[model samples]
Target: MEARVMICAQTFFHRFFMINNIAQQPSSVPAGPKRAGEPEHTPHHMMVAVACLFLAAKVEEYPKFLDDVVRFTYHFRHGKEATEALMADKEGALKVEKDRVLTCERLVVSNMGFDLHVTSPHCKLGPVVDAVLEVAAAEGRTDLVREHKSLLSLATNFLNDSMHHLICLQHRPTRMAAIALAMAEKFMVGKEKIKPFPRVKVDGEMVPWWCSMRIVDDDEAISSDMMRRYMKDFHSQVYRQDDDEAIS
Candidate 1:
């Protein structure tokens, strides 16, 4: 259920690849003291947001129709009150949006040095969740195995929400997947009174950079607690955007 909600919402912005941190991109760029004259076009927030949605429908395997994506995104951006004019004049709206999408897509593709392949954490979900469960079982914690299905749901939601942050790109899909599971475990322990086990660490990989970005004390694979902190920090960024949007 959570997965479906996220996948549907994500249909708009398939890959919002922003190199700049959310802290750098404010809702409104304030005028500063004049520097050497320059205003070269870079992909801004709205452009990247819409383009990701437009492109995702085409690129993702299940293939939502272009019309569905357009309408879905429109409602997502502007609540769910669509009138006849909005629905009837789809072509006109889409033509304008497509132009914006094209410009942003080109800039993003080029800006990232043409690394068009944007990896999503969805694929690595199974192995990551299994690792969590396996760790639990090894620790003689059958309670986690008993609630595996719910934890899987929680993990899916966490990964989906995590995608809202540009920091996701700094980590590999596998690392993102593992982080999602760790986050799920944290929620599971706190919400359901599940016995908190010792933090399970992934043996091989170094810690993801985002985890080290003041979220963790040292460079290490994020444990359950570190991931919870990371997500708390991450969601605050999303909330900031939401607040700005509401005001604007």
Candidate 2:
């Protein structure tokens, strides 16, 4: 469920960025620029983010009530005291906020051209993990089979962490799955919990374990160096956030 929400949020932000870029483009017809302060013309970021999450929940088949979404959004954006006061108001602020969210939802859908289907790397993680384990078993490496749960958990953690960075936007789902598995295997090997991944024979040539998974075609084959570069960037982002939190 968390994975689904994260994937949806990533898709929402991606579409949001695209919409902003298109909106900023110069119009062919000469017209006065709308004032940024206009209430109708300017949508609040919080409202749009909540709307995206609301729409994403529906898309992921985990529908949430709009009222619950709005309430939670307010609770998170404002503190408990402020939200309670707003909810108690007779001026219909909550109703107005709900209306704004609905309006933004339409804007989001229109800007997205009604394309809401989003494929997540989480879906690919399972198959990738299975392929690796199958190869390990084929090589008479029973140790990996025994550690299946741990391996899957580590890979899942890596994949979830990847969602926090723009690396998801930079790579396809298949590539992200491969990277997650690679990171997991590397971490396990570093801890001496498992032997390094065994190479598999592919078309008479020995190839890395990921090569057997068919994550990408030969033309789009990723190299070890490339994987390392991606992992480095991923770690940097994660650690940078940790440092910021520590300072805070």
Candidate 3:
């Protein structure tokens, strides 16, 4: 019964939260400064508050930590604000007591669980390349298909250690494949590299700059049906442009 409740909660919350995220306008830029007249407990405040909460969850068995308030400060200031801003609001009037911050952090932890990690296209490069290959095969674009496959492998290799920055936790195989595919499409269609090829310390390793049309069949393999489901789910859950229309 507890397990069932957990599953149900996750499903309902995931649906609503994803829909809400979709409804918001997509911004390539980092979040902007808050309006001057924004209220104390406004959504922006809640966003900062939620970061504190997630930090508390990370420390406790729950989902946040007391120190997350400082983390929020770092994010807000982008390492530019004075330390005093860590204690009070921008106007220096609304002070956040440490105890209150801890309490809110606990509240956030209870709400979000300790699962802070999320999936991105970095994870799905493999399957996306294969999917593109299938599409390429259908189009009879052998050169383009092979090019995409090569790019897919290169992107996946580039991400091996960098995935830590993308998700911050252990890799989930299914999500990894989806992210890989999306990345492959981005490169193949855009005809550009998303990031510089990662430097290798090992004596013998393939480098993206030196290689062309190198085939990696194992990289194309998807592990399970669940992985495919996760890939599609993550794409739908996270990457829609028109939030209101994207959720449905």
Candidate 4:
């Protein structure tokens, strides 16, 4: 169910910009957060995810009725609710959740400092990929770069999927793009790329991604090992069984 909500959240982000001119949507003015008690009936994570959908609707201006969003979310989350009508008279719980959604929306909008414009993975990651390629070339890995002609595109694809997870909100777009690109490069070149990088205490006996990727960008502040750790944590996140259903 979280997967479905996450997909919807990503959809809301994309759909908003798609409906509006790609660059025209203004950053949401800081409207300030609402002070409401955490919803007791539904999981806090569920409310937060739903709130993202509701907030996206308003910011993008293709407002989805709160009722529709509620029913849409509950329907997939609960198999029994799958056939339920959107009508308000059927059950008052939908209305309650609607209020929760609105409240949470306010909290999210305020927390985000009202920024609404979403960055494309390409735009966000292009520089990172270019920098990595430049580093590879300088390190005499141009042979590998030339062999992987579609490397950047492949990395972008991985970023597209990574955006489905909540990490986008947690980390900088460029950082995620870099990690995705590193992973792509790793896929193309086996462990042969691993170099002896500065070890981070725990991996003293093990070869970390930083050692493997030869990524030594000080500005990025994340070692390949840390990036690999993030990747491990990210992939370990709970995946929703109903993800494809939501996207479809």
Give me the candidate number with maximum lDDT: 2
Q: Spell out the clash pairs found in candidate 2.
A: none
The positional error of residue 166 in candidate 3, measured at the CA in angstroms, is 15
Question: Each candidate's lDDT (Cα)?
Answer: 0.55, 0.72, 0.41, 0.54
Model 1: per-residue lDDT, tens digit, 1-248? 13433453353343433444444444642222224665543445655665555554444544555556556666776566652345676567555555556666565556556544555577677765565566668878888778888878877877776666554655667666766666566667767646654443334544432233232222354554665555555545544432211211
Would you estimate the TM-scores of all the predictions?
Answer: 0.58, 0.80, 0.34, 0.49
Off by over 4 Å in 1: 1-44, 64-68, 75-94, 138-140, 197-248
lDDT of 3 by residue, 115-205 (tens): 5343433434555456445544665656754465467675565344333232313244443544444444444445543333322222375
Q: Per-residue lDDT tens digits of candidate 4, residues 1-248?
A: 33334444674543333333433322331122334783222225555667777766565456777777777777766655442643444445555556667876765555555665664444656665555566556667655566545667666676667666555555555566666666666655554443322232334554443333333332435655587666665555423432222211
- Model 4 has how many clashing residue pairs? 3
Across 54-167, the per-residue lDDT of candidate 2 in tens digits comes to: 888889889888878877778887789977876786257767776767777888888888888888888888887777777788789987888888988998888777776667
Q: Total clashing residue pairs per candidate?
A: 4, 0, 23, 3
Worst 10 residues of 4 by lDDT: 239-248
**What TM-score does structure 4 among the candidates reach?**
0.49
Q: Report the Cα lDDT for residue 102, model 3.
A: 46
Candidates ranked, most accurate by TM-score first: 2, 1, 4, 3
Tell me the lDDT of candidate 2: 0.72
Error of 1 at 170 (Å): 2.7
